[model samples]
Target chain A: MKRNSIIVVLLALVCSLSLVFLSGCATDQTVKSNTIKGDANISTMETAKSKAESVALEEDTLKEAALKAKREQERLMAEAAAFKEKDIHFDFDRYDLTSDARKILGEIASWLSKQNGWEITIQGHCDNRGTGEYNLALGERRAETAKSYLMSLGIAEGRIDTISYGEEMPLDPANNEVAWAKNRRDHFLVVSKK
Target chain B: MRKIIALLIFSVVFWCSSAACGKVYIDINSPAFQKFPLAIPEFKDLGNMKPGENLSAWFADQLSSTLKITGFFKMISQDAFLEDQSRAGITVEEIDFSNWSSIGSDFLVKGGFSYDGKNLAVEFRLFDAIEGKLITGKKYWGKSEDKKAMVLKFADETLLALTGKGGVFDTKIAFVGKEGSSSEIYTINFDGSDPVKVTTYKSLSLSPQWSQDGAKIAFTSYKAGNPDCYVIDVASGTTQKISSFRGLNLPASWSLDGKKILMVLSKDGNEDIYIKHLDSGSLQRLTNDRAIDVSPTWSTDGKKIAFVSNRSGSPQIFVMDSEGKNVRRLTFEGSYNSSPCWSPDGTKIAYEGSSNGCFQIFSVGEDGNNLMQLTFEEGGGESPSWSPDGRYLVFSSKKNDREMVCIINANGSDLRVLPDIKGVKSSHSPSWSQHLNLY
Candidate 1:
């Protein structure tokens, strides 16, 4: 029984060694080319992905700066637009400006100084107190007086135009004193802006 | 003193024209005139006239209406006549003055008409009813279709016999009539008989001043979108622009000889009066005041021009020589006065002045004395136009919130709304024409 056991152990050791050696040889010949090609493809894919990410980040930064500049310009334009909303008033049967008119005109002059490439038209009006023909002339004088005042300021004369509406286009169509006060005025209209 | 001499001459002529003159029915110089009671019998239709459509009645009706328009005669009805006369009895021998005198008629008119298909013959006689004598007689021959002309001629002759001057019943009035939102130029007879639209511009028009000969009208219109002055021939409706100077081109007055037109032009950036010669198109600037000067009117002799100016801080009447020399302000009392029209006789100027915020018509002597108020009523009166005879004034009146054309006697009596105009409720800026005498 002892002699049979020794022989079996030797046979087992020999079979194990033969199997290990055969498997090692097969791995060396067939798996060598595929593993190196696979490693090269993975490294090239990683470099291309990193370069694309870097270009996308740089474009986002430039877009952000351009948006900031456009927003600033719009804010300045909105401020200059506010000066066109007010009108100058006059007294009854008179083309001379009241104190209130001069105050309003000064504000307009300051705002116009900051704006470039802007032109305005000044329309002179009158209350229904005199003859139509005479009122026309009176209204013209009123507009010219206003233009002269603007010229005394830094505003350019060529940027202003004048027209007289007489009593035809009244701001207030009533014949009473309160309405006439409102109707006798110099109205401003923006003709062009760049 | 000169007026008294004129009355004396009129009285002598009146007494010499009639055989038995005693008292005058109407005193021409009186402030409030007394209307004469005048009798007009039916016009007799002679043979072959056929009297179609009551032709005889039409003739008598026209004559009576024309006489009443003068505002000097009160027509006595036919029912009040003492005797009925036929065409054969139109002679002096057949008319018995006592018959008319009994009816309180100071004057009588008898006429006859015969129309023979193509031609018409009309005979009329004016008589001083209490004198038993014929003052004047006339015979007219015209086409049968021209019966209206014959009737108007006879009426003119009757007025000439009584007043030593023909009536203005043949005259016309040109005014601004509103159509929709725009105003147009219109012409109507003196008694408001026929209203004819002279302009179809369908735009704002104003200040329609008739030429002295009544052949054309000068007005301002906005057809070309500017207040431009235009002259239109009344007969042919042909229009020609006289002034289109980039601004207000308002007509002020036409010269008495029809040789020139004075207008207000604002082309030089200010209002100034300008005279434009019709034949040569030459323009002359008359005033250079920096203040407003407008609405120029010429005197009877055409040697002077009166205009409205605000040089004294308010609009007032100013008179200057024809060449713009010798400038004199004529009004000192009012803060506002406009529309100064010189009287045809060169003795007075009628204008509109505001009193207590009510505009009324006033007349002042040429030398700025004898200021007389011609109208007083609710609303206000403006644009006073004088008759050619200087006996009546027609103006625009605003009463009851409606605009109306009114005619008042020069003495401020007999104020009445001009009759037969449609939609006169909004009419303004009346301009009376010279005696047309179209017939």
Candidate 2:
């Protein structure tokens, strides 16, 4: 009976020690889960902040693209208007370029330089004073003179084409010096743009 | 007395025989030539069926007008005719020669027609009023719609008998008719009748030249946004692009054999004349000058080419061989000479030269000897195209501020504006076609 009492006391003491160890493990697990939860909350907050920043960045990129496209459109339109702004005139039955004509052609060359992927056509016209056959040749000469001048000014030859109207299509149909001067001209047109 | 009468009769017989032996009745080349007086009585209605359409008066009027347009015949007034219209005869055996000869009729035309509303048979006879001999006779069978054609055929025969050359009655003149900003090719009869629209390309089409066979017309058009050379089949109205070189593709003339076309091209950096072979599609550049070279015309013999060039510090005509060699300058008197046209005989070249601040038609011998100015009108003449017989020229001129097409004799006489083409503001660039074989 004395030995039985001693064994029971030892068993109770061992059971108390095991219960303390299990409680310590459960406290460690609870501490780990709480730490994990806190870390998750921080991660969620960081994710939200990054998402907001990304949305704002995307909007900024889209606005910038729209602004760039608008600018490109405006530039193209301006270039087109400038390219067709004026026509160079010639004297009676003459194909030689004058000083004013040269200046205008120089301006045309500059506009063409900016307009890559575009093509131009130079329509040569003449007054009704000369014969149609001769005027046809004269118109061609005027167009060629302008084209040659433009090519000399660094414009590509392939980008330029020419046609002669030969007094057939006149800007002014009146029979006077003013109308004739206006009719004898080199008109520029934008044939294509890509 | 007997011997003298026999001698006179022998001489008269000789003269009549000579007149019948292909002797031309009219010498039109004479500078002092006078218009031949002609008379035509009302045609006889030989039809046994019911009378129709006043065919007698219509035939007489048609013949008179057709002959008068040649500037060769002076029609005698029907009121002055002594022959009774109701009993007049068409056959030489049944006519009184004194009636025609006394009325100053050197030639007389008698016509008779039988019409059944669906078909018509007509007979015509040309007689020398003095000798009362039938010079030519023709009988035609056709429908009522062929009345004009039959009259034209008889007129051509009469002209052939008198002038030793056929009339251009069946030919057409191709010209550029302009309205607003567009110009198109239009064709009209030689007498300015039956105006036909040839091209419907509502763009600038210029320099129309007829093929030798009259089956096609080659011209330049801006319809494709470039001056491209196109040949249109006249009958079918189908167009084909023959040359579309990057630069000026103006067709000027076709070869005599219809195997080649002469065109002005600027593909080699400037305007130059080049001949394109129709069969091989091979191009042979005939001119290589830095100056403007254009308006090429092929000679009838196909041995030479005449073109206009501004190489001598002014525009002038130039002649070269078919192979593009032996270039010689022509037209030294003018500062501006262009639109070189070779005569059908290849003996003379006609062009427009600037004179007195306006262009006038001028012609020079192929050897450059006879440089004659053919026009001195206030508005001036340009684009001289030769008739098929080489006896007349057709050109464009401005009269009363309106552009009109005019025809003139080769001797620079009888200049008259063709009747106006209706509904067109102006007409220019007239190109005369060869005699079309319509029969």
Candidate 3:
């Protein structure tokens, strides 16, 4: 009779251990599936633990998306900056495009052609030597000349716009020839990008 | 003594006959014209109110300065006066004329005022000091704030009595006042009293053109990220974008009938002159040239338009009929001539011409004769606009690296810079308004 009681107690210990092991597996499954379904409900302790794990996984996903979007915005801004860094200059009181101006405009046209949904505005500027009104019209001619060149290079006309700031907004405010050479030019600005 | 009295009577009759036939005491158009010497003493306190602001001297100074700006009268020194000014009579019947005559004062202005802190009543008398007779007199009742207006009105009457034409005291000069990167439209009195900001666009506003009726101001602004032409009502402060073409919509002038505006537009891939009807919003292309055309100004009679174009290899002034035919180049001397402003009489056009690497103001007859250079300053002059009476031209000039508003007679005499307004760094593109009917 004593031997029979010992065997019965050992069997009871084995059964309780297996039940604990089975619940452990069940909790692991619930955590994985709850991450997908966004619902965690089971035993009280298991529910709480699975909810925490699912919240962490969602946070990771959101952080990854935000990082991707930020990177894209930075890339576009860099591209626009690169496009606007170069300016094509003109002679004093003249708007005809020089050979150097044409070469630079060709490069701009190529870049703009590669850009899928980008648009740019060409700001024509002038030196402060002439009357403001006449310089205004001269600046317009400079911008229009640039626009026509870009269009000739297969860039869509709708992708280009022009404005003449006259002598009002000079890149260099000095009253010398060096500053004037820098002031009278066509400056590019990216208005839109995909 | 009887012979002296007879001579006095004869001279009085002579003066009366000349004045009755509208004889001008000063012929401002003559190249050898002289400034009329005038004397102004401290105003007498007729009301004897408690002294606060010393308005007796203040009113006298205001009247003196107002007359001084017309370039017509010269103020005599008070120290040179032989009379006891403090106790002198303001009327013709009570004073001695020999005191002013000995001082070589051709005219005398005497004022009496009563100020009770807020309201003011003033009396002014302009005298022919040589003849010892009153020429004109005025009495005004107004608030203290209207003191300037009152003084200006009396000065206007005095000018009429002297020149047979009124002064531009009630007129305002609209100009582009630049602070930093931004520019706005501002209006100052012809005498430089009130500086009012007409635009708060916070962007680049240029070339303010006042309408004929003094009710609206048209200009070009980059407010909406584009250079668009807009008109603002002077009374309501309401703005309307009249032209928003794809590129380059600049206002040049307004029609006398207030029904249309002349502007330069570049929608045709080239800058050209265009007229926009205010009622129908329909545009009439005035010039369809391939060259750059800008700065269109209408004649007073509305029969012609003056503009600047580069079709002749350099920018020059050209005149065309109102319908854009009969285009004639008016300037052949300057390689770069622009900013053509038609005179009030429609006989001449004033413009800025480049000379010795600097710009100068010049006026040429409509028939392309008698080219006269108006300004010879080293800093140069530009953007000339005529006064209502056609006696003066207001333009922008630089002095000591500071941009200022300057006035010169049509004959290139009496070049004076208007006093600068505090905190204003630069002012340009002055458009003198028509005579404002204000009391």
Candidate 4:
């Protein structure tokens, strides 16, 4: 009787095993644990990347503002330098530097001496009594005179360029003497060298 | 004694032409001046003149052309008078002004030339046809070429005595003749002898006017890309652009005082007249009209200006104060009238008039009355400038096979063509010089 009972239990256990296999029921512990680990690693990496990017952007904006402020300060300084009184003049049909003109040019020479890497242009003008060609020649002479004067005062020769405007770009249009006096002048402009 | 002096002053006022001192003056506005039928007695030649070198005959041709083109005199045929050479220089001895008057002439022009080694002295005398007296006389001492110049000056003097202003015969005129696309500015003797090139820019140039002092010429040149007003020194050949604005710049008349340049500028969006200070380069806007106001010419006295505008949809002449105040319309006739030039005497203004699709030279009084058409037919005239004496006008026109420079009398009589250097398609704008050679 004991042997028959043991045999019936064994068969029942076999039937249950077959039925579970046929239904394809199984649980994967390694896959579920691997998915959970994968999700945690991805979120942690994304958070770190966003924090680094935000810090870099903030640093870039701070650097940009500091550069702009420095540039504004330099512009204001240049304006103050140019604002001092300057009176460049010429003789009749001559570009030769007079004592008075050189005195005014002396101030420019000292100012230019302070700043390195600054290139400048000297523009000459003339009155309207003579022919246009003659006035142009005269203007060129005047500009060169100023340029040479600046060079004589120990300024580097390559630092200054000269140009002539002739009578066309007059500072005054009056036909009287006062207007002509104002028209015959040389002005300066700042430029960058190549 | 006081009564006698008062009577003398009264007679002086009553008979002005008859009033004589060491010099006798003729009435400039003499009523009979419609053309004093002057008899230029076949100018007598002095002995042994070389063939084709009959200087006096050349003088007669020049003088006849000068007077006849003036619309003032009919050169009565010289066939009625005798020609003698041996006694001609000293023998004005035979000219009977009464005989000329009897021949239906109102004046007499006679010339005598004497060569005394170093210089040839030519003397000329103009006679009053009715007053029966020598109105004025002059003597010139120079070379053969100088003698021609002398004769022209004498013609001018005669015209001046008759009209109270210098003749344009001695003045120089500048014009542009374009053959194909190439153009050049040429200056010719009023009789058109030396049609010499003033500018050979190889580009377009136009609107030339002499400076008030006659030392420089202001014109528009395209040599620098666009049209800009350039002033060239007459003697030095130096060029300078006075009005090289960003847009079109053209010369009008120079101010009478020789201080400012009155020209047209389109820099302010539309073309307007601007008075540019020559020295200070200051520009003062003169007119604010939205219409295209161009071709500004100052009045002779410098009080007003006249220019062309299309504000009414058709081009007409308008006059305004020099400061651009109180503008008024001057031409109610014709659709296209432009390039107005005031007479030197300030009596009339000459402009090219277009009507029925053709252009003609027309003159109108400053009062806008007496509008007379001074040209006829087709291929019309442009840029009519008055001779210094206001008797003749120089304008560009087509004659024969090509376009040539023609001088028409203000009365529209005796249209004569200036010498066009073998009669080629040459000449136009002809800004007459302001009476040079006074020195």
Error of 3 at B80 (Å): 1.7
Which rank order by lDDT, best down to worst? 3, 2, 1, 4
Model 4, CA-based lDDT: 0.69
> Can you rank all candidates by TM-score, best first?
2, 3, 1, 4
List the candidates' TM-scores in order: 0.74, 0.86, 0.84, 0.60
What's the CA error at residue B181 for candidate 3, in Å?
1.2
- Candidate achieving the largest TM-score: 2
Candidate 1's clash total is 0
Model 4 pairs in collision: A172-B280, A173-B280, A173-B281, A173-B282, B35-B72
lDDT value, residue B80 of candidate 2 = 93
DockQ of each: 0.12, 0.39, 0.35, 0.01
Residue runs of model 4 more than 4 Å from their true location after superposition: A1-194, B1-34, B41-58, B82-106, B127-135, B398-402, B422-426
Tens-digit per-residue lDDT, B271-357, candidate 1: 899999989998999999888888889999999998898899888999999999999999988788888999999999999888877
All models: lDDT?
0.77, 0.84, 0.85, 0.69
Give the clash count for each candidate: 0, 0, 0, 5
Instruction: Put down candidate 2 lDDT per residue, B1-439, tens digits, no spaces.
Output: 0011111011121122323577897699898899989998888888753544678889999999989888898999998999886876877778998999998998999988886665677888888999987888777777666778888888987888888777888788898888767888988888878888899888888888999877789998989988899999988899989998877899999887888999898888788989999899999988888998999999999999999888988888999999999999978996888898999999999899989778899999999999999988887898999988888899988764357889988888878787776667778898899878754
Which parts of model 3 are misplaced by more than 4 Å? A1-79, A191-194, B1-21, B50-53, B115-119, B399-402
Q: Model 3: which docking level applies?
A: acceptable
| lDDT of candidate 2 over A30-124, digit per residue (tens) | 99999999999999999999999999999889888889977977887777666566889998778999999999898888877887766778889
Which of 1 and 3 is ahead in lDDT?
A: 3
Docking class of 4: incorrect
lDDT of 4 by residue, B76-117 (tens): 887765434344442334554566687777777776665555
Q: After superposition, how far is residue A89 of candidate 1 from its true place, in Å?
A: 7.6
